[model samples]
Target: MMNRRDFLKLACFSVVGTPARSVFDRLTGKDIAGPTKEGQPKWAMVVDLKMCASKPGCRDCVDACHSIHNVPAFNNPKDEVKWVWTDSYKNIFPEQSHRFVSVEVQTRPVLILCNHCENPPCVKVCPTRATFRREDGIVMMDYHRCIGCRYCMAACPYGARSFNWKDPRPFIKKIKEDFPTRTKGVVEKCSFCEERLAKGLKPACVEACTTKALTFGDLNEPNSQVRNLLASKPNIRRKAYLGTEPKVFYLE
Candidate 1:
């Protein structure tokens, strides 16, 4: 019984109304609601300071992590990084210029990478669920699902995520047997070797460290070695003031 113009208007309204209704539902958590499954274990890492030394050949951790992750070796800063690397204070942590006397410590190269925060701001800011918090308390990224928005990268306070500006496959030579190659225009970072962890193996970086400086275990587990180590040693997390509550701990 509707006229031509009235029918057309009704159709347009229906189309618009459907999307608006969907948006309202999403806001009410009706779109993404899900039940949390029990028995999924949470994992965390603790780095022991007393055991870690900044000597040469001590970069096994860096080498191991990079090789396993198939990270590109771009000397230029523009195209670099994936999993792990070392950075000096002058490089990673610079002193404030306004401060009269900077007490900034220039300790040996601290192996710097993702902290995998328990409550990751990066995950919350990602428009695409590319970066998400796993039930195990590890912050993970699904590069395949990522839309190259770079929102998660910017949201990260720790500078953990790296953007692949170009094709990474060409730079990687003699690819490690365990790691997979990443493509361009995606964000990547350390996943704490979830693949290895699934196999009941330690992270490549932890295994590669000759000094056994890196400790990987469940921080939630009271009887774990990392927990015991924290009890005995004086440790600090990088930028605790940020309240990221990083799983990686450093010994002073």
Candidate 2:
């Protein structure tokens, strides 16, 4: 990891010389912007529809994820901020759509969030290196380094990135002290609770689910819950044809 002094020297604005990086990325530290590290667990989430359907009015997963991440709610659909939310099956999986598909299946909503794609378009278009994939395959956003260019937002096909049009703190009903609240202009989204993972805990959404609707674990381990669930269920990704290789899957 680069120390503060090294980062300052590398990223600091120079009057006479060309800048090596944007003042932001350099100030925020370069290591977080780098490639995946070796031997780290690749995290993935599986949404099981059977259990999800059992809890009709349950918004526990969304609430837990947002509360823990300090995600704000502007309430307007145009400026809505959500790390996890409900989406209709047809909208999420248009490729699989067919005439007169079961009414119940069509109407049933599914959880949607960042896929944390293996080939993340958001990471590719980020000029400031604000968005990068971690060693464990979790795509992260460094809010401090973000320039709010919205290039990553345009690049993302999953509609996962949310830009704060206003300071989000005031809109947050209940704040999580340990979690950092994003300021206006930085893009934010589901991090898969990298903070909790570091402390040997599961993501808040997964832990809060009463019906065990959400399953998360390392994809590398063959016996892991995520992998086992995948093997046991015929699952589908949001856009598997695009080749982004989204880590999130849905079983309906």
Candidate 3:
């Protein structure tokens, strides 16, 4: 088995050494930015509900992901730029909820983000191809190409994409040099920390999770943590009936 260091080294090589990677692809650290097919290294995430529920008021993952990605804090829901945030259980899983459901289950804080679905509706509606699913199953956006049409946002069922109503740079407390801040009239959402993945690091949210509630790995790997967790534990995906084939799974 490859050690962590070795794994990271190989990851870096795969990210950098891949042939014909365009400038945008290099900038985003995605091998090839387009529709991903089967047999590729499909990225996925698994959220452990019990572990996350242990800390009722923790926003460590949200804060870390936002701070690193330059997600502006409008302090208003109308203009909030959220890469990751918690939601009520019922809102996230309406089919899983009932009046008889326990309060703990009803009000469970479920982390939500872009599901990076295999058949992303947002990708299909994008006239300019601003948002496309990478070969690794990561849904990514080209901010420069986004005409603020909001097609992707409207097509997205998860409400994952955030549009810049105005200049967002002013709202950021401090910008991380590693990532670019979006301009007005562009759409943005979680990229699963693709740049960090290129550096062989986990997503900021997953790493910042002290309770280890967030698990990320390639679903194609037989022994991957996410695959193992999915196999051994009962889990659910948001809106699975829609046939989007969401990659993010939640453990109950």
lDDT of 3 by residue, 115-162 (tens): 998878888778888888888888899998888999888888899989
lDDT, candidate 2, 21-110, per-residue tens: 555555544434355456668899999987898888789989888887888889898888889998878888888887789978876888
lDDT of each residue in 120-237, candidate 1, tens digit only: 7677667888887776767888889988998877877778889999998888866776667889999999998888898999988899877777888876677888888889888777
Model 2: runs farther than 4 Å from truth? 1-38
**Ten residues in sequence with the least summed lDDT for candidate 1:** 95-104
- The most accurate candidate by lDDT is 3
Order candidates by lDDT, high to low.
Answer: 3, 2, 1
The per-prediction CA RMSD against the true structure, in angstroms, equals 8.6, 9.7, 12.4
TM-score of each: 0.77, 0.84, 0.85
After superposition, the stretches of candidate 3 with alpha carbons farther than 4 Å from their true spots are 1-39
Candidates' C-alpha lDDT: 0.74, 0.86, 0.89
Off by over 4 Å in 1: 1-39, 89-105
Which pairs of residues clash in candidate 1, taking residues 3 or more apart in a chain or in different chains? Answer: 49-251
